[model samples]
Target: MFKSFNIRKKIYYLSDTIKRKNVSNHLKEINFILNNPESNKSKIIQKSNLNNILNHATNTTPFYKKFRNFDSILDFPVIKKLVIQDNFNEFQSYPHKDKNNFKVSTSGSTGVPFFLFQDEVKRNRNKADVLHFLKRSNYEVGHRLFYLGVRLNQKFSLKSLIQNVSLIDISKLTDKAIEDFLEKVAKDKNSNKILLGHVSAFETILKYLDRKNKDITNIKLNSIITNSEHLSVETKTKLENYFNTPALSRYSSEEAGIIAHQTIDSPDTFVVNHASYYIEVLNLNNNTPVKPGEIGRIVLTDLFNYAMPLIRYDTGDIAKTKVCDNGSIQFESVEGRKMDLVYDTQGNVLSSYVFNKIIYKHYKKIKQYQFIQQDKKEYEIKLNLQEDKFPFEKELISEVKEDFGKDANVNITYVNEIPPLASGKRRKVINNYNKNNSLINPALSKHESIT
Candidate 1:
């Protein structure tokens, strides 16, 4: 049955490749560069593409017009989310035409929203890039993909069937909802299935399955790919162990289609998609390129999005980078956003994953939880309960106090709903202390201390 599904997927991809004029060629070119990362041709192609996009941005975009004659890409100032939010009109290279141009808004996970426009071709390229990456994981075009993320506005139709995606709304991630989703996957036993979504959503589902003692062997999955949030080692391990498959972490954003993905060869490190965008790790203070192995802010330049070229756009995430022996740019470790870390009373910093694991353990009753670190000593936890009254409220508080410290002021506020970020993303942990500290701080450089 799996063999038949694979054959059908292959046939569908081949037919679609023939129908699409230039998509196959684009995929081939990207694949070639990916296969030969160290080749001089690859470097030349990347440089040429970057230069072309930079030139286009300078000439056509109002935001970059002032830097038209900029001798070097570095000379141009870096644009932040606030700049894009305020001067949105200036960023557009051309006026939007219905159906021809696609408008997308960032999930405002950073508290500031950014609206972006892309040409139809660019949109197709984004989809192509995703397909190309999936192919590397031995995923065919028509394979079953369980997407546990936002509910797309489009209704189910032929296109949806062709895409072969089963959308599971992250908002409706209750225990019953997860059980139903699992049951549906169980029914389709033969199809090669892949789970893709935000890390928290997958974690929630995993916890639900674990709590119910569900036999994951009955619903086999080929791979698990998580994005939109930091995929921690613990979460990845849990996913891999439960699904009996490799869990791949994808680093991406709405502004940028897919910045990096963990390949089969390098499961620990994320290799940049050189064909789609150019990545640079720059110092947060001066925007200068940081040395290999040093942590720095991520800046990306979209090579394909000509409708609104985003050159040297600060991605707000911090990561360490190194040029591998094969000459590919690899992420050493992604610490996520500067404001994503919580500092405890002992001045020990904790990754957002620390609290996520604790909260998700009680996911059946706690529908949603947001940890807000007001300061080193004061903490506020807001929860959207599955029931009117939380039965384990005392246990939850005790567990939190144990981690935070006995003297710490940990307040629990029950709310009907926790507001999502501008990007419609619900952050598990929010560090209010670092909200205004945009620049990289020395404390954040230290590794996460659980105690």
Candidate 2:
């Protein structure tokens, strides 16, 4: 009657063992935090990890050595990606050791690149964190994943075979390729499959299906996770409608791994990766913690990344957040990048969601789009249409003028296809004018609507 050694658990343990990554303890610790988030054990583990990392970072690295006297994360300065670039060598754990250490890099949506050194413990913990989040999204240890990517030239490998991950390249997603992929999943109806990739790739698939009037209600996917780009609420509904399954948004980054994930029941609020990251939502102007439900900068203290030891690293992301009594961090919504934030003609602050609204309103006509604010009153829109005829060009211009200003110079250009960035993400909003990271607008109030 005591069935502790299940097949799934056996596979999980054996797989980790095969890789020589003893992540059982790490995974257990993560589960403990998730289940007993408000428990004393959870608080102690979080606090201890924070203190240990700070202590380790200060003791080992020259960069953090100055902050050695300061124990709390709040005492340290919140650093940006640029700060890491300037002090790359100083951040690494010195003494010319740690053979298990490795390097990782990311050229994010803004085309800005940053790198980090990760130790074996941090790598294993990241693996465990990803697994923990995926498990919450109906993913088991054995389910095959239909991965979407861009410009990735993948080949046959032992890991791919063992993991059952069919990496489909989205650099050029042909209709035939999509149909065949859907057929493969539908072919194995009982075996629950998973789909994970960029939000844009999923949109392309949906657009194709809609164009062809195809039905794929029999795919029987365990979960559909859109990541690597902003996953809008409207698009999530469309994906779920067609796939007939729970479509969730996975908010992750190259810097930290899985940050937060939306649950099936709570689609708006994301369940934070409390297992690995001690998250803080701070105001834009002031680097202090923001109140729950208020939008702020997502600064993370990586409890697991001991190699580089990132203390109070500003993630360059904005989000409305909530912290439950049990020490769980939930994001109401992960808004777009801090730089991608747009503005009105007179330089009034605008919610990035305004662009999403325009895209949603014109989904039927526009295949792909990019909004660029060139000058204070000059705006440009590049559109790849679903069809040749766009009869509402003037209406679109008028609508944009309403936001940018009635006398604003707004131009619209039709394109064959809006090309994805080098990072494979289609940046929907780009403010080329300036970077006003401050939440306060001296022109008027802190924020203003399109009206």
- Summarize candidate 2's per-residue lDDT along 20-108 as a digit string, tens digits: 89787788999899767778898899888888888888999988898788846766777778878888888887853456687888875
In lDDT terms, how accurate is model 2?
0.78
Report lDDT (Cα) of residue 285, candidate 1. 52
lDDT of 1: 0.76
List TM-score per model, in order.
0.83, 0.91
Residue 33 alpha-carbon offset, candidate 1, angstroms:
1.7
Ten contiguous residues with the weakest lDDT in model 2: 442-451
Once fitted onto the true fold, the runs of candidate 2 whose alpha carbons sit more than 4 angstroms away are 1-12, 18-20, 95-98, 323-327, 435-451
Q: What is the lDDT of residue 130 in candidate 1?
A: 84
Candidate number with greatest lDDT? 2
lDDT of 1 by residue, 1-451 (tens): 3245555566666766777746666777788788898899988988898899898888887878988887877766666788877887888886442446778877677777667888866787787788788876657777888887666554776555665777777776777888888888878754588888888788678668766788868778888888887787777888888888889988888777888888667788987888888887887455567999877778888898888888877788888888899767889878788568676678665655667667766767776788988876788889887679877767777777788788778888999987665343677778886665432432222221110
Local distance difference test scores for all models: 0.76, 0.78
